[model samples]
Target: MTELSHEGERLQKVLAAAGVASRRVSEQLIAAGRVTVNGVVVTELGSRVDPLVDKVAVDGSAVQLDPDKRYVMLNKPTGVLSSMSDERGRPDLRAFTAEYPERLFNVGRLDSDTSGLLLLTNDGELAHVLAHPSFGVTKTYIATVTGTATPATMRRLEAGLELDDGPIAADRARVVGEPSRGRSIVEVTLHSGRNRIVRRMLDAVGLPVVELVRRQFGPLHLGTLGVGRTRDLTRVELGQLLTLSREPGRPRSGIGAPDAAGTAMDDDESDSE
Candidate 1:
């Protein structure tokens, strides 16, 4: 049992407010030795914690105590720019974010033509690390390309290719099915954050992309979320992302200037796709 300070809200009450469980169930969870405060086992009932200050976890997964933080996943549709606002007056993410009271900004970016999972959040720390190319968060895409993707092409993609910007390689690549009607579906996974990297890599391998959709980002997946729709991240998904953001070798600071919505934008205008 951990000692509680005289100040702050009750531990179970905080957990309940965080939507972890009801106040009764939260007390039961604490009594079961499944909760921790500041990395210490905190089984004592009636323990107090500053929701804004103390780090809390249940079953080794961090709990999001601050209510101000919001994590949203949007299945961005094609023809929409990843930016919240586009100077050219093109369709952008403003329509998706309009419902959320918290000012949310995209974590990274996707090209106007590519579509799928896009993360919008007000959590600057997680956004900074995930969007930073140095951290190397993996993204998976399903692309329909103009040519048949043979095993040789898959091998070449995995083996790597030299692009105009630099040398790049897919962490994983494979054909989803046999080619038909002059096009094939190929899945590629890479940690690179370069602009239009998937399309460029496939083109280098002689498979020019006709259509592309991101299937996954880090631990979050597009799942069944429809295009042009958005949903809040589940507690488990958010926990996984937070863990990834704090992994070893993550930079403590330095991404770029925060936009109006408080997201860290990379110095390079086109680093994300």
Candidate 2:
């Protein structure tokens, strides 16, 4: 076991300050062997860690020790640009960021005419991993299209299709319900970060999107959040996202250790728009 130096803050104190728990409970968790620092379980309550450098986990979930890092989820409304600022003075995220002191930016993007989940954060590393096409984090969308999307169509989406940009396919796709009137609701999930990828994919499948809304991004979901409102991410949501942001095979250790287990909802509402 590596000895903890006295140079950094005590592990329990860091955990408590990170909103994991009260210092006393943090101490209890540490002593109970529920906490690990960089893959090694740390049972010593007095063990110290640099919040900026040392990775800490509780019960297998990565913890965010940096207090200044903010993760926000916004249910963006249609016609709002994904950018913090629009050069043409169009509706943008300034209305949302103006509510927080943090200079946050969107993790990826939502089309100006499309709406649903949008993540805004000041954590550059996380934002980069999520927004970069190479990282391949999946996003789920509920799109209202022109006609009923058959199982064959969904299979075609899953099987793959060619776009003007390149070949692409959904990680998963399905028809949400029986077609109502002239429209059908479809749910599509894909990891490509290509611009307007969802819209393009649906068009290629002969189901032009009439309305599109992203219901999920990685582990975060829109979940009954009203359109145009923003809220801070729950501890569980943050932990899951931080875990996703890490490179493959990094320790799945924890923070966000609540007094009780935290629950996150999976929103699959087809009518998210």
Candidate 3:
């Protein structure tokens, strides 16, 4: 019998962290005599191995540790649920991230009817910081509202409105473009992650939203990413996100400064429930 190393992580945890399988399933694999460490079969559940140095394998196949974490930006298309899988077989982020070997989950959610700038990651700690409201991660959205957005309506949104859950207010709200025939495009930014908060806030102020899209989250931007497409964030981009997560109070603007007409960029589009 090989002596288990006290300094290294448990074998099952290393396997699960590498995205091989869940911890329970990994234990089963070990009990079945399929797991080997440094060429020795390790059926003992308490067996530990240095992931960086150990030659871990399953059924003669070497298992490499995926030490580097992944952060992905997905331009979510409407009608796809913001989940890894669905019990009712609905389309989800998995369909787009099927090629990635890592077990990734959405950092936050976008309603099935709403879409844009959804993030997926395997880094749980970073995901938690981004999703938590205390971190003050701001999200910016451009909404197409049914009613003409006069200055009073913008004031109402910025001042605050009562919702079924609680009071919500926009960090900023301004007209994005010229209102045409009672329809106007408005840009709003806030930190609330309430379900359908954007749509509900507009409705509360008597400006029913016809469409909405998140253009920015924290320091990340959607930036012309085509709908239904996904891409990995660059090292620099990932570093910036980490830095922002550490300093929660830092302010983040949309793609650019508000133009002379006070219009923000119409980066993407979506319909809401």
- Return the TM-score for each candidate structure: 0.90, 0.88, 0.66
lDDT tens per residue, model 2, 1-273: 448788999999999999999999999999899998877899987798999988888898889999999999999999887766555788878898898998777766677788999888877666655655466778899999998789999999999998887898899999998999989999999888676788889999899999998998888989999999999999999989886777574333332211111111112221112
Model 2 residue 54 CA deviation (Å) reads 1.4
Best first by lDDT, ranked: 1, 2, 3
Which ranges in model 3 have alpha carbons more than 4 Å from their true place? 1-67, 248-273
Q: Using alpha carbons, what is the TM-score of model 1? A: 0.90
Question: Candidate 3, residues 104-182: lDDT per residue as tens digits?
Answer: 7777778787778988777655676666545557889888989889888889999999889988899999998799988
Model 1 / residue 8 / CA error / Å: 2.4
Regions more than 4 Å wrong, model 1:
1-3, 254-257, 261-263, 266-273
Candidate 1, residues 97-138: lDDT per residue as tens digits?
999999888888888788899899887777888887688888
Looking at model 3, how many pairs of residues clash? 0
Clashing pairs in 3: none
Model 2 is weakest, by summed lDDT over 10 consecutive residues, at 257-266
lDDT of each: 0.85, 0.80, 0.75
Worst 10 residues of 3 by lDDT: 262-271
Candidate 2 residue-pair clash tally = 5
